[model samples]
Target: MNKWLTIVLCIGLPLAVGGVSAYVTVQNIQNWYPGLAKPFFNPPNTVFGPVWTALYILMGVSFYLLLREPSSEKKKQAILLFFIQLVLNFWWSILFFRFHWIGIAFIDIVLLWLFIILMIRQFYRVSGKAANLQWPYLAWVSFANVLNAAIWYLNH
Candidate 1:
């Protein structure tokens, strides 16, 4: 595949998936029971869009950096982990927002956090730049995990 195309896919795919998640979350937030009772620390609804967009872009850049590596089993594993975590990210939003399942969303975010750690380790092995790119994404997810847990605990 062409390099630019690969770059675009690395970035575009995650953005597209995250965009869908954001749209769904927005649509269902008012209808979701627990989300309405979120803690004061819960950012205003406006904060979510920009934060998620930046994180998704960071995620895409991380994947793009990984793709620059020469083909290898390690790189392949790293790429796989990247996609896995991305899928988990989207699932968490769907569970929390659309299905109104805060508990399950918490579980999903925890697993996503673990997977991100794995992906970070793998990215480090393949490309330090890629690993670095994931830092903000990991940090944001870490915060989200805490928020999810809090939401589940408070609303349960």
Candidate 2:
């Protein structure tokens, strides 16, 4: 496949998944989220959209770079872990926003953070840039774990 196509696929898939995740988030942000007690550290709702957008794009590019590696069992495992964390990424929003399961979402975020860290390690062996790309994501999710814990504690 052409580089352009690869780039498009790399970026497009994550954005598309993020768009779907946004569908679950937008409604709750307007309705349910406003009522919840956010941590003092929580930023205004406006921050999340842009931050998540950039992170998702970075995730896509990182995944693309990883995928470009020679096919190997390690690559396959890394890819699986990548998708697993991505699923957890979307599921966290749904669990917190849509279903209103704050405690469970907190747990989910912790697991997600761990999975991201593991993926970073695995990606490092494959592509240094790809591994580096996940750093912001890991940092954000680390902060998010604290936020998630605080919110759950305050609310429940």
Candidate 3:
């Protein structure tokens, strides 16, 4: 693949998936979401859009770094972990915002967090920069897990 094409895919794929989740998310944000009991730690609603967009871009960049690795075996494992986490990330929005399944969303986020940690470890073996890029994602998802748990507990 050409370098530009690789970069585009690296960044575009995650953003596209995020865009899908956001489509489902916006539908409920005003109606279903506002009605739920939220945790005290919940950031203002405005914060989520920009933050998540940034995270997705970071995820894509990390994947690009992993993809650029010379070892196909290492790339394969990291790519697999990356996609697993990305799918989990996508489903959290759907499960929580679209279906209003708070408990399931919490579980999904936890799994996503774990996958991200594993991806970081795998990526570290391929590219330290890729591993480092995932740290903020790990941190954010860790925070999101706590937030998801608190919301589930509070609203249940």
Candidate 4:
């Protein structure tokens, strides 16, 4: 595959996932979300879109860097971990916003966090830069876990 095309696809994948998740998220922000009990630390709604966009870009870059590494068993494991976390990331939006399953969302986010950590560890083994790129993603998910927990506690 062409290197540039590979880069585009690497970046595009996470952005696409984020786009779909955002679609589900946006649909609820107006009607269903505002009614929820939120923590004092819950960020303004406007913060999410840009933050998520940035994070997805970072994730894509990370994936790209990982892919650039020589083929190896560790790289395959890292790639698998990345996809697992990405799937978890997508489902969190659906669980939280679409289904109004706050508790389930919390569980999903926790699992997402775990997957991210594992992904980062595996990414580090393959490419340090790739793992480094995941830091913001890990940070955001950490905050999200707190936020999800707080929201669940407040509402339930």
Q: Highest lDDT: which candidate?
A: 4
| Tens digits of per-residue lDDT for model 2, 7-58 | 8898888788888878977788799988988877899989998999999999
Candidate 3 stretches with Cα past 4 Å from truth are none
TM-score, candidate number 4: 0.98
- For residues 3-28, could you state the per-residue lDDT of candidate 4 as single tens digits? 99998999999999989888867879
lDDT (Cα) of model 2:
0.90
lDDT of 3 at 66: 82
- For every model shown, what is its TM-score relative to the native structure? 0.93, 0.96, 0.97, 0.98
Model 2 shows how many backbone clashes?
0
Give Cα-based local distance difference scores for all models: 0.86, 0.90, 0.90, 0.94
**Candidate 3 lDDT:** 0.90
Order candidates by lDDT, high to low: 4, 3, 2, 1
Tell how far residue 90 is off in model 4, in angstroms: 0.5
- The runs of at least 3 residues in candidate 1 whose Cα sits more than 4 Å from the true structure, single-residue gaps closed, are 33-35
What lDDT, from 0 to 1, does candidate 1 have?
0.86
Error of 4 at 52 (Å): 0.4
